[model samples]
Target chain A: EPEVTQTPSHQVTQMGQEVILRCVPISNHLYFYWYRQILGQKVEFLVSFYNNEISEKSEIFDDQFSVERPDGSNFTLKIRSTKLEDSAMYFCASSEAGTGHGYTFGSGTRLTVV
Target chain B: AQSVTQLDSQVPVFEEAPVELRCNYSSSVSVYLFWYVQYPNQGLQLLLKYLSGSTLVESINGFEAEFNKSQTSFHLRKPSVHISDTAEYFCAVGAAGGYNKLIFGAGTRLAVHP
Candidate 1:
């Protein structure tokens, strides 16, 4: 089965530093998304990207968070200034068409902003 | 808007015992429901999803869920469970639009003890 890929399985960054989480979605996927889960909390949607631009984003995705599909394969989420609360397992997902078929998710990048 | 709620935070069951994970969703418009499973230290995996069908959806791992429009619920069930089934399960809701984002519920940890 096709799979979404995420690099830097675990990342440790100092608070107020910049961090970029990278993801390589399925080659044919049209919709991409980023979500994060804090310790013991529900996974929250951060942002969605389609057609080389952001389609939707949740309240959690403030100015500090930005997503980019710089290339055909790599989709990256950059945190301009990391905060301790930003520590969580970040997930990258992709869908072929619509969400009706659900999404294929990557193994995730555990970001620890200390 | 769409939202999901998973009723139980944790459920402990013996191997071979039946288990049910309750999920409810709220959306002003028709929505799709999904169940995602996360093994320890792993990313979320799509277990099953319910779009528009017989109101019943089944995963390859012997798990099933029924969508009830009236109750606005999509509870997952398994007649028997194994230790390998122990994991955190998340319920998600997505609006019916062409490409909408998903809202995930607080996960339910299912522990199948031997």
Candidate 2:
């Protein structure tokens, strides 16, 4: 089974620093997404990307956050200035096209801001 | 807009016992329902989904869910669960359009005791 790969399984950064989380979605998938799960909270959608642009984003995804497909396969989420509240498990997911096919989520990167 | 509700926050069951996790959703438009599992220190894995056709869907690992459009529920069930089934289960909903984004519930932790 093909899998979505994310780098830096765990990351610890100082507050107010810049951090970039990387992900390699399934090769054939066209729709990519970034979600975050705060401890004991529901997984929240951050942004969705397709056709090289952002399709949708939530209110939580403010000016501090941005997503990019820097390469054909690499989809990344960058936080310009991280805050202590930014600590969470960030997940990368991809789907072939529609919601019917469901999605594959990466193991997630645990971002801890000190 | 779509939202998912997982009624139980945690469920404890003995090994080989049957278990059920209740999920409900509210969507103004048609939506796709999905169940994902997350084991300790692992990423979210697709358990099953309901898009169309038969309302009932099953996963290879002995889990099944019935989509009740009238009630807007998609509850997961396992006749006999093992300790390996211990994990956090999430119910999600995605709208049926080009730009589909998933909305996840807070999650239900299933603890299978030996």
- Candidate 1, residue B112: Cα displacement in angstroms equals 0.5
lDDT of 2 by residue, B16-114 (tens): 999999999999999989999999999999999998899999999999999999999999999999999999999999997565889999999999999
Residue B22 in model 1: shift from native, Å?
Answer: 0.5
Task: Tell me the TM-score of chain B in each candidate.
Answer: 0.98, 0.98
Model 1, A17-51: lDDT tens per residue?
99999999999999999999999999999999999
Task: Output per-candidate TM-scores for chain A, rounded to 2 decimals.
Answer: 0.98, 0.99
Model 1 TM: 0.98
Residue A67 displacement (Å), model 2: 1.0
Clashing pairs in 2: none
Weakest 10 consecutive residues of candidate 1 chain A by summed lDDT: A97-106
In terms of docking quality, model 2 is high
Displacement of the residue A51 alpha carbon in candidate 2, Å: 1.2
Determine the TM-score of chain B of model 2.
0.98
